[model samples]
Target chain A: MYDDRKYTEENMPKTGILLEVENTELKDINFGLVTAARDTGANEVLAFTTEELGTEAQNDLARYGVSQLIRLRTDSADITSSPDNCAAACVQAAREYGLEYCLGLATAFGRDIFARMAALLDVELAADVLQIDFKAKTAVKSHFSGKTMATVSLQETPGLLTVRPNAISPVEQPATLESSVFQADIQSQAKVAVKEIKTSDDRKMDLTEAPIIITGGRPIGKPENYAMLQECADVLGGAVGASRAAVDAGYAPHSMQVGQTGKTVSPNLYLACGVSGAVQHFAGMKTSKVIVGINKDKDAPIFEKCDYGIVGDMFEVVPALTKALQQEKQG
Target chain B: MQIYVCLKHVPDTAANITLKGQADYEAGAVKFVANPYDEYAVEEAVQLVEKDGSGEVVLVTLGPSEAVTTLRSSLAMGATRGLLVKTDEKFCDSKTTARALHAAILQDGSPDLIFTGKVAVDTEGSQTPYRLARLFDLPVANEVSALAINDGSAVAERELGAGNREVLEMKTPCVIGTTKGLNEPRYPKFPDIMKAKKKEIKELALADLDPALDPRPNLGKLEPVPERSGATMMEGSVEESVAQLIRTLKEGKML
Candidate 1:
């Protein structure tokens, strides 16, 4: 273990990306993935949490050419996430390393937790940044202000940014590196306790990170009929999305809803089934490379935003699309 | 019970916004109001305090003096008090606004619960409540549609995707970001509106809070949403339109 006292300011490398793992297993996964995504820049990639990085995650990180992994241990295993603790830790880390930027995954937990860190640091929290131009020293496209794209630069030290999950394609490279574990200064019990962990059984993937999304609106009519859209998503390896109108109308859950009021997504492919393509709904997913709209109303606003329009009953079209996917997969 | 509801004044949702030159559209010829979503937050706090039968609800805002309108609107909804932290235009962003709020909340002592809308229509940040929860070291439930305060804890149903729902039980001193389904925010009654005129609104300057936040996105330049072309009507029977649609879909390779 590197002594906190012995590690002086001059020797510490600049620019480290930190990730908190859900468990020791996830810690491994995060380090592995992060190391794989690392570049030739002279710096470090670290994962900090209650547990040490797993051997498998270390190996993965090595594959990606990461120089080393630093796992910071926490006192309690069941520490809850708080904006305060994260902010304090991040700010301390940034100030110590004289880092340029802090990067985080744009998960629901990250969005909630990192925004506070940005607030505490007195720097802007650039949410849902799709691409980071390291050479240009800029962040490209954050999710905010309704379906808009922006590139931001920070004159200040250690600007915080959250990366859209699928936006950065993870790559694998082989390397040889050592993994070191250290304890965090803040005790885990000092942080807020996560009261609960709830996972929806209906989805195989998280909506915010899904590469493909098939969404529906109130036009889908009944809640039970939503299964048809789910079938399409299942075949595409995507998650189901809903419009706020659909959620307010009792057709879907609020978590799945997307708009100015809900989650913003920029998947590779977005399919709107029975969604009228309201500006609010479009605002959430317009960044997608391809949009397909299936609506009975030929004049539905969604047709304008979509690359393809299916003027037909979503009920019939969705089943057929699912069947097509099944056939392609089978063949 | 002392309850505080955070409010923000925002551009009216109904305004026909146009893309003027580059940096933040020339925001002219548009109407503005207290953010519509925040109204629900204030209403929920007021209702919760009233349900308890003996409590005071306070409205707090970190913005310019113009934000007093938002505070007054909350008072008109039956809130007993108001606090406004006036600052430069920088407080317009959520991070700066949240820091200002943390300062105010710390000065005012602990609140049992903090409520905020899922996001403001102008800034459209759904992360502030979560961030605030972090700042206070409180548990948070984001985008909740329904909530029930129990003994020392609150049970809330959060909307998840694909018609899935998660009911999380959190302890007191927590933060919740409410969705539109929480309740129908009440319109200001006439009597309450008149009483709000006499309500004491404590206006604090930015200096008083010693704000500790950079109020910029710090990402890159802002760009406006592209304009939609005029609507096109398919002049044909439904079957003919479907044929044309299939043709369009195939041509676009969506088929």
Candidate 2:
């Protein structure tokens, strides 16, 4: 069955969603940007990727209502070699497509590219927004470490905005997919050259983008004990985190620390083990949809904020949960 | 070599931020300090000059008159001087801040390199370096965790999360927004502190900067984070609790 939209197809505003690829695989998060760009199911969505999208990536985005997928072409300059090159190329692609707004995830990669694009275009950027209101040309963003939320309007176009990853849920809206390539007329000076890229030893997803997070606090005795959380996180297809206490105590690196002093995360599920749920740690992850706390003390403050609580030793309880999740996964 | 570092005087992370009215926090109640992230930038710049053996590291900041104190604190960290762009507003969007900083940097002449924080702790608008770079037409990189300056070029390593590192080589006169793990900031010694108090800092009203535009309305509606209601705490044995947790997550389709 062919479905017709109430509005004229030619009259809809055009939006371009920049797809991110790592290790020759498209990040699953891009689909959410596609859903977000299809505001009210009328704005025509175009997906742009610096690299060629495989069949899997193409089908995934198309199911999210992406009407057009564009691969940027380059002559001598490699987009992967420089952020400036990618920014220049993407801005050119957006213009060639007549895109009213260019939207992307606010991941580390997206932030670098989109900010440059906004600067190159001389347009005010809405960076790291949590929600978008196309009708008013505005976005909602967190301020003061998530203590407050601010609404900002896009005052110009072709608009440049980056939505926080996972902030917008991906909706399956089927549309005929159109695939093509656009050669970017990049007038970019080669000021920056990429030397090398080294992946981490663990190579796990970043905490801010991980859908599920399993965090350990002071209780995990040694650095190696984080493996307990890691085992469970692996089963859940999530990332592991450490509280500020763990970092200060030299149990984990500052990169894995989750607190106002560390990374601010809003995951689908937050499993806190031995964490006290202090304001700083809480402030960093209070936006998580579901919080589950496990502590030895029945009255731990984490229980007050958690969606579920367990008064037990993490050494025993974590393994039990991991085993249970493993069986659940098998079943 | 001439190096410039951009600093911002922001509310301390520990300080409470209660709104005075709309878009304005209670200024008096919150203690202001050099943005902790910017401290990284200042430290990286000061270290660069120290390593070069012959160069000047200048600290540039935007804030009210009191912000000079923050600038001096950076100077005590071994910077040669300071440049303060005076503005009473507690907050300014990244665009205006970048424009003002661009103009202030030009006053000191074209810098060999510019450094700033990946994101200001207070406003957290992380686009200033890019915007400022555009105003200069130079290349820029943000969230760099490691860096080594070479002859008129720099090799910087930036964290892309998931433990991935992208090493880049940028030509001189570029902007860099540093993050944690770059370098440890040093606390100033007693004599250095006294000398920093006397360090030269040029002050200019943001208004005086080439007809700077008024602060844009970045905040249309500002309010506190919504209070979460009706938190649930599951009971019973460890296995039972885990089962209940799984059930709820599945029901919500968050699993």
Q: For candidate 2, write residues A248-327 as lDDT tens digits.
A: 88999888988776887778889999998887788788778788888998888888777777888999889998998899
Q: In candidate 2, which residue pairs clash?
A: none
lDDT of 1: 0.66
Best by lDDT: 2
lDDT of 1 by residue, A192-304 (tens): 34444466564356677677898988878888988888888887778888888889888886677887667778776788888887777776777765677778887887877
Q: Report the number of the highest-TM-score candidate.
A: 2
Residues B1-255, candidate 2: write the lDDT tens digits. Answer: 799999988877777778767677787787888888888898898888888888899888888999888888889999999999888876676778888899999977879999999987766678888998889988788888898888877888887777778898888788999887898899999999999989999999889875745666567777788755534776788888878878888998878
Fnat of each prediction, in sequence: 0.27, 0.65
What is the C-alpha local distance difference test score of each model? Answer: 0.66, 0.84
